[model samples]
Target chain A: MNSSNSGNVGIVIVSHSPKIAEGAADMVRQMVGSAVPLAWTGGDIDGGLGTNVAGILEAIETAWSPAGVAVLVDLGGAETNSEMAVEMLPEDRRARVVVCNAPVVEGAVIAATESSGGSPLAAVKRSAEEFYA
Target chain B: MHDAHASRSGETPVPLTASAVLVNKVGLHARPSVKLTQCAKGFSARIELALAADGPWTDAKSPVKVMRVKAPQGATLHFRVTGPDSKAALAAVLALVHDGFGEA
Candidate 1:
């Protein structure tokens, strides 16, 4: 069995729909394999189409990598909640996280691929943002 | 043609070169581009992929540049590699492309 501790940079996908987040993560896994830590948070606590801070925070923890974690959100509310989740982390830990401005699916795919290559947090974020190009 | 000649002017011995058609249904989209970049990174060579057989080349290590080619299904991609592991890099890319990126 392959343990989740592959040492690659981690990735968190935030989306309004659980399906979207999971589907995107699936694509990432298919491309990069299981070497990178990956997690997703979607919908609200009540099963509504909204973003939840706790869920996002937990997702971040699930995918935390010593290299760092990059968060990709689908919409504005998800983006806002993702930032709040990062802020909730310890100050030192917060520095290791970044919220990227890119399409959720494409960003997650690129970020996962870059992270699996043992890239640093910033470079992973940059590669994810390259989706805009 | 022109780009191939231009590349030769550098006097760099490009010992590895190959061309493949994009057989995947979606072509060089985000996922495939990621796969291509990751493969290039595994080698120490300077890898490049171009839209034509001979011309301007973009760093294959850059997912953004790989996506810039916007290669669609049936579009041909040319790969040129230089460095110590150039041959290995070219072989890997050719195999991946031949497999249709596992999307065929």
Candidate 2:
């Protein structure tokens, strides 16, 4: 078997804090490394609105597809903003957006590394695996 | 360019092939890099990444390894994975990139 395509899962990360988003990704590398398909989005971080919602939408449209994509966001605006982004998508595309239910960092890592066959919700659930610690 | 472009349409199942283009303005920093690398480990396929034409190629499943590549904005990496389900890996990569790595 080749080294890269070992899994069929896909992942996406979103956050109100850009640092948090990036930081979370870094932590995952410390543990599992690259083993799944990953995507991410974040707010302006200027403590303002973060990034443009439209930009996030465009990224989602372009990056997510075929088998759909999942999203893991930080608290507060991250969740609301993610909702806005999801709403912007076409009905067909909206079907692919999977939002995570746990802390942003953990959710991002689990979704990115888990072997959930591209299902975001499942990846988020997998993130719960770390809670016992 | 021609051969590379041809593969974008889900053409021939090249041996362990994947691509990473800078979609986020910040490029593949610690966060995305880690996240990207994590996804690479999911599949049983053997994955390798070439940051540039002359750059060193490394395993997609390694974060520290991927970090060394230091993929910057607008920089694109070509990935190759062979073995069963390689096509699935390629598709997932395409989707992630097509999503602009979350920065489009």
Candidate 3:
């Protein structure tokens, strides 16, 4: 079912602030257009400053592709929540999603660029993580 | 060019090089840097960029490294490319920069 779209890997951006997540996704869109599936989520269920695992999971579904989804997060809480979200996926879908340890905005931009170029999931994750290394 | 015979015998092959000035209003900001890296990654060459001819070069395919260059308007971008497609890679990158990254 996830493979129905183009083979490009998908990207999900997570942050404590909804604005940050949206801004990062905007940057990715500006650079990559619709070449890759992309989504973003942030803030608590109440729309306050915090990470929402449920929101992240929904974002993962929205951004899902057979090439897999790379999740970029802004802070520790976002990372933890993203991991929880990944764990919530069914076993078959779980292995395909990764919570990358990368800078939220820059990583998303780079990851989307790489994914749009027909790179595989691991390569996309590596390229995003290269932001720090 | 340097002696072809000497270059062939040396451990290091002469890298194809080129330079282009960033004429765009904002220079290598986030948007332009993204374009630059995207173009660079289209080739198989080992491409690097520097502020000077002899430089502390950074990988051209890495957007984060390219963004950190922080090259403002009028700054000359020096490129060093080495690989099977080095010539074409250098030309493509120079063309993109000369086009003002499509922003000018």
Point to the candidate with the largest lDDT: 3
* Candidate 2 chain B worst ten-residue window by lDDT: B9-18
* Clash pairs, model 3 backbone: none
Q: Write the per-residue lDDT of candidate 2 for residues A11-74, one digit (tens) a residue.
A: 5556665666657656654544555455555667455546557645654554354555556666
Best first by DockQ, ranked: 1, 3, 2
Per-residue lDDT of model 1, residues B1-104, tens digit only: 99878765543574577899889999998778888888888988898888887768899888777888888999889998888677778999988888988776
- The candidate scoring highest on DockQ is 1
- Local distance difference test, per candidate? 0.85, 0.60, 0.87
Task: Kindly report which residue stretches of model 1 are placed more than 4 angstroms away from their true locations once superposed.
Answer: A1-3, B1-15, B23-26
**Residue-wise lDDT of candidate 1 within A88-130, one digit each (tens)?**
9999899999999999998888888888778889999998897
- List DockQ for all candidates: 0.52, 0.05, 0.47
Each prediction's RMSD over C-alphas, in Å, is 5.2, 14.0, 4.0
C-alpha lDDT (0 to 100) for residue A131 of candidate 2: 37
Q: Report model 1's TM-score to 2 decimal places.
A: 0.85
Residue A104, candidate 1: Cα error in Å is 0.8
Q: lDDT, candidate 3, residue A86?
A: 95
**Tens-digit lDDT track of model 3 for A44-67:** 999899999999999999899988
Residues B1-104, candidate 2: write the lDDT tens digits.
Answer: 99778766543455755566777776766566555665665666777778765447787765445656777778887877775667787777667655766655
lDDT: worst 10-residue window of model 2 chain A: A1-10
List where candidate 3 sits over 4 angstroms from the true fold.
Answer: A1-5, B1-13
Q: After superposition, how far is residue B97 of candidate 1 from its true place, in Å?
A: 1.8
